[model samples]
Target: MLTNGLVVDLQQKNMKIALIGYGKMGRAIEDIATKVGHQVVLTIDDPDFDAETLKKADVAIEFTTPQSAVSNIKKCADAGIPIVVGTTAWYNDYNDACDYVLSKNSGLFTATNFSIGVNLFWRITEMAAKLINDYDEYDAFIDEVHHTQKLDAPSGTAITTAEKVLANFGRKNNWVHHENGIGSSTNELELSVRSFREENVPGTHTVSFKSDIDTIEITHTAHSRKGFASGALRAAEFMTGKSGIYTMKDLLNE
Candidate 1:
């Protein structure tokens, strides 16, 4: 919100938020939202939730599964509510989802990893990839770890990191998932993303540029869900008074 040629600090005022998906992330967002002077007006856990209730708040934050993310976003858009989505493995329909949200004149904020540190790490990865692209002696790889309960392998965070590296690192053709250090990649042009699931990991992602002499690495480890929650709150704040699809790029740039 540019008021008087200055960005409005949305966190300065209270916001009424509706939470879609009352799981761990939902609870985390609620905790941070309230502590920062915002209100969680509603929480929806059921997939068969009453879609009309989403209209009760200034913005809605969704942390549901991939299977339900599109439906939930459409419902929020239908109800004229701005929404911030934190679900992964749902991008097969992302373009259509954006079209539907835009058609409804609703704002949608989406992110793979909603941690400020992770986003910064991504930027740094991009910078390093760009600088090393012409070196011809380096190859890129990613490793991501999460809690056992996490549904997706490689994680949305790692996926975004791969995208950043691939965009700048000309030698990499595509990203391939691996487990137990075995990627089965047929060619070197494929970037490897190794995935691990442990008992209680919040999340950890590392990007490395390797050569025979030495290796360069960057890592971001999440201590808890608080960073994700906090960033989601900021995204919700940014989505207010807006109507269109937005992402971490928009929020961070602002």
Candidate 2:
């Protein structure tokens, strides 16, 4: 299942999947899922889709917008279907959503980004953050690029990276996302996460620690959506016969 503590293709079962959002990410997941001999029993493209059909699926993969992620999670929970969520910007309600699923005796697996490289990138970034934290001479910030059509500004990957950074950065207690202007609640302890939108860019995230002497940067760039799609399906497979909340760390056996 893991190659030197990193995730790789290690499938043991073919599952009936319920695709909760038939958008780009959903289509991507379905294409790979079908090629791997998995069946897609149901798809929800509209808000009015039948929730009863969820019971037909062994696992549900949700890639909907932030506004719709919570309700979709609840429906899967009600159906007693294990769900893997790839949506971002809905984390404020994440605890409630996971609690509801757990109460229903269903499993929940969620990730901000499903690419294998991104998961590894977080670890590399953490190592850098921890080493840099011992000295206050360098300051760090995150820079991310995504497609223009992406709903969230700072990309969920950037936020996750910042969380890893904050865990060790002695001076930074929180992160600030820079949109048209600086996000509210600016403070000295806040690290900056700058976002850029371009055409046809899958995604790219860089963490830079800069000082007056030199700058250190680490980056992971995605060429396409295939990596995310494959990882999400593998996560679905991992959810089979499992209960409780899971993340990429758990899936990769980290």
CA lDDT of each prediction against the hidden true structure: 0.88, 0.88
lDDT for 178 (candidate 2):
86
Task: Kindly report which residue stretches of model 2 are placed more than 4 angstroms away from their true locations once superposed.
Answer: 1-12, 180-188
Runs in model 1 deviating more than 4 A are 1-10, 184-186
lDDT for each residue of candidate 1 in 1-254, tens digit (9 for 90 to 100)? 43332223447568889999999999988877886688899999999987788777999999999999999999999999999999999988999999999999998999998887788898899999999998999988899989899888879889999999999999988999997456557789999999988899999999999899999999999888878888888999888878998988888883
Error of 1 at 200 (Å): 0.9
TM-score of 1: 0.93
Please provide, for model 2 over 1-254, each residue's C-alpha lDDT reduced to its tens digit, 9 standing for 90 to 100.
54433334547467999999999999999887886678998988997776688998999999999999999988888888889999999999999998899899989999999988899999999999999988788988888988889999888899999999999788899898887334543576889998888899999999989899999999999888888988999899999777789999898899
